[model samples]
Target: MSSRTTDGRSAATTAALLAGPIVMTAGMAATPWESENEITAYQAALAASPDQTQIAAVLLFFGYALMGLAFLSVLRRAGGAPRALRIPAATLAFCGATMLPGLVVVDFYDLALIQSLPAEQAAAVGERAGDYGLQPVMQVPAVAGLLLGGILVMLCAWRSGLVGGWAPALVAAGLVASFAVFSGVTMVAGASCSVVAYGGIALRLRSARIPSSPPAARPATA
Candidate 1:
C-alpha cells in the first residue's frame, strides 16, 4: 500500500479504537435522556417499545461519538492537503464541540426525572430510576449542532472531492441517514453523526491504503 493509504488506514483504525471509550462515555453520559423524560413522547416511545428505543439509543450514541472522533481524524489527515481542508474539518470539529455540552444537560435532565418520579415507578425500573427527569435547554443546541454539523461535513466531503470515493460516500450517507433518524430528537442527530463517523473512519482507512491505479485516458491523436 502507498504511504498515504497506509497513513489513512492507520488513522481511521486508531480513530475507531479511540471511539470505543468516547461512545461509552457518551452512553454513560446519556442515561438521563430516558430517565429524565420517561413520560415525554420521545421517551414514551422507548417506554412503550424499549427494545427498539433503548437499543437504538445505545447504538446511536456509540455511533455518534465514534463518528465525531473519526471526523476529527480525517481533518487531521487532510491537514496538509489544501487550505480548503479547514472548512469541513472546522465544521466537524465545531459540531462535535457543540454537541459536547448537551451531554451535561442530558445528565441533569435524567437526574431531575428520577427525582420527580413517584417511589413506585422509580423503584419499578430499579437501576434506571436515577435517569428520570425533564430535559434541559441544552438539548436544542445538541440536536442543532449535529444537524448542522452533518450538513457541513456532507458539503465538505462533496467539496473536497472525497465523495468520489467509497469512504466519502459512506460518511455522507451516514450523515444524511442521521438527519432522518434523528428527526424529532437529539438522538436522530446522534444517529446521523454515527453514520458519518463510520464513514470518516472508512475515509481514513482509504487514505492509508494503496489504491488501484486510475484508468488512463486514451490519446486523442486520431
Candidate 2:
C-alpha cells in the first residue's frame, strides 16, 4: 500500500472501482437512441421521455466520476506491472476518466436545448452540436482512455498477480460490448462484464492482504 492510503480511501477506491462500471453500464442501457437525423422525431422523443434520457445522462456522469476517482488506485495497484506498461495505461485511463464522463453533460445540454428552444431551432443547434461533439478528435482519446485503458489496467492487474484470469477476461468483454458493439443489448452485456471486472477486482482487493501499516491505514483494524 502507498504511504497516503488509509482505510477510508482504500474502501472508496474499491467501491468506486465496482460502482463506476455498474452505473455507467446502467446508463448505457438506459440511453435512448439518437434519431437517424430525424430531428422532429428526436425532438418528440425528448419531449415524450426526457426523464429517461436525463436519467441516462445522470447515470453516465456518476459512472465517469467514479472511474476518475478510481484512477490513482488503479495506477497504484497495478502491483507488479512494469513502468512501461503502467505509463500508457495510466495515461489512457486518465483521459477516459476525465473526458468520457463529462460528455454526458452534452446530454443534459441536449435536453435543455429541446426543452427551451423552438422545434426547428433546437434541431439546428442539436445537429450542429452533434457534428462538433462526435468528432474523432474527441472520441479517439475517450475510447482509448475508457476502453483500452481499462483493458490494459486489468492486464496489468493480471500480470502483477493482483487478480486472476476472470478480471481481465471480464474487462475485455465488457469494454468491447460497451464501446465497440455500442448497442443496447451489447451495452447491457458489457455492463454485466463491468460488474465482473471491476467488481471482481474489489472482491479480490478485499481478500488480498496488505503489508503491515499504521492502524489507521488498515480497515480491519478499524
Candidate 3:
C-alpha cells in the first residue's frame, strides 16, 4: 500500500482503540454494585431487571477485546525496537490482553452462579471460584502485563522518536499513578493518559512523510 494509505490505516486503528476506554468506562458505570455486600443488592436488582447484568458483562467483554486490539496496534506502531525490549513488551501486553476477556467471563459466571444457586451453595461456589478459577490465576499476571508493557512501550517510543514531547511522559506517569492510589479515579486517570498518548501517536503517524531509500554507502579509499 502507499504511504498515505498506510498512514490512514494507522490513524483509523488509533481511533478505534480510543473506543476501548470509553466502552470500559461505560461497563464500569453499568456495573450494579461496588462491594461484596452489594452483591446481594445486585441480586435483588438483577431480579427486577434481568437483562442489565448480562448486558453489563457483555459490554465489559467487548471493552476488553477492544483494549486488546488497541494494545496490539500500539505494539505494531512501536516496531523496530531492540528485541530485548520488544519481546518482553509484546509478551506481557499479549498476556494482559488475552486475560482481560477471561476476567469478564469469570465475572459473568459468578453473577450467573449467584442468580441460579441457593444462597449457601452460591457462597460456597463463589469462594471456590475465587480460590480455584482461572480468574485469580490470571488477574495478577494480566495487571503486570499492562503495567510493564505500557512502560516498555513508552520507553521504546521515546527511543525511536516515534512520539516526543510530554505525551510519553504523561502516559508513563499515568500508568504509575494508577498503581499509586489503586482507586477508581486513578484507573480513569491512567486510561485517559493512555488515550492521549495513543492519539498523539496517531496524529504523528498520519502527518509523517515517508522517507525515501537511503543512498548507497560510498566505497572505502585504498
Q: Of models 1 and 3, which has the larger lDDT?
A: 3
On residues 164-212, what C-alpha lDDT tens digit does candidate 2 reach at each position?
A: 8888788787666655655567767876776677666677776664656
Each model's lDDT: 0.49, 0.75, 0.68
lDDT of 1 by residue, 168-194 (tens): 455456556634554334443444344
Q: State the displacement of the C-alpha of residue 134, model 3, in Å, after optimal TM-score superposition.
A: 7.0
Scored against the true structure, residue 120 in model 2 reaches a CA lDDT of: 90
Clash total of candidate 1: 20
Worst 10 residues of 2 by lDDT: 213-222
Q: Give the C-alpha miss distance for residue 200 in model 3, angstroms.
A: 1.6
Q: Candidate 3 residues 98-189, lDDT tens each?
A: 77677776666666776798766766766665576566567887777766776676666666677775766897788788667655566667
Report the alpha-carbon TM-score of model 1 versus the true structure.
Answer: 0.48
lDDT at 29 for candidate 3?
Answer: 55
Lowest lDDT 10-residue stretch of candidate 1: 29-38
Best by TM-score: 2
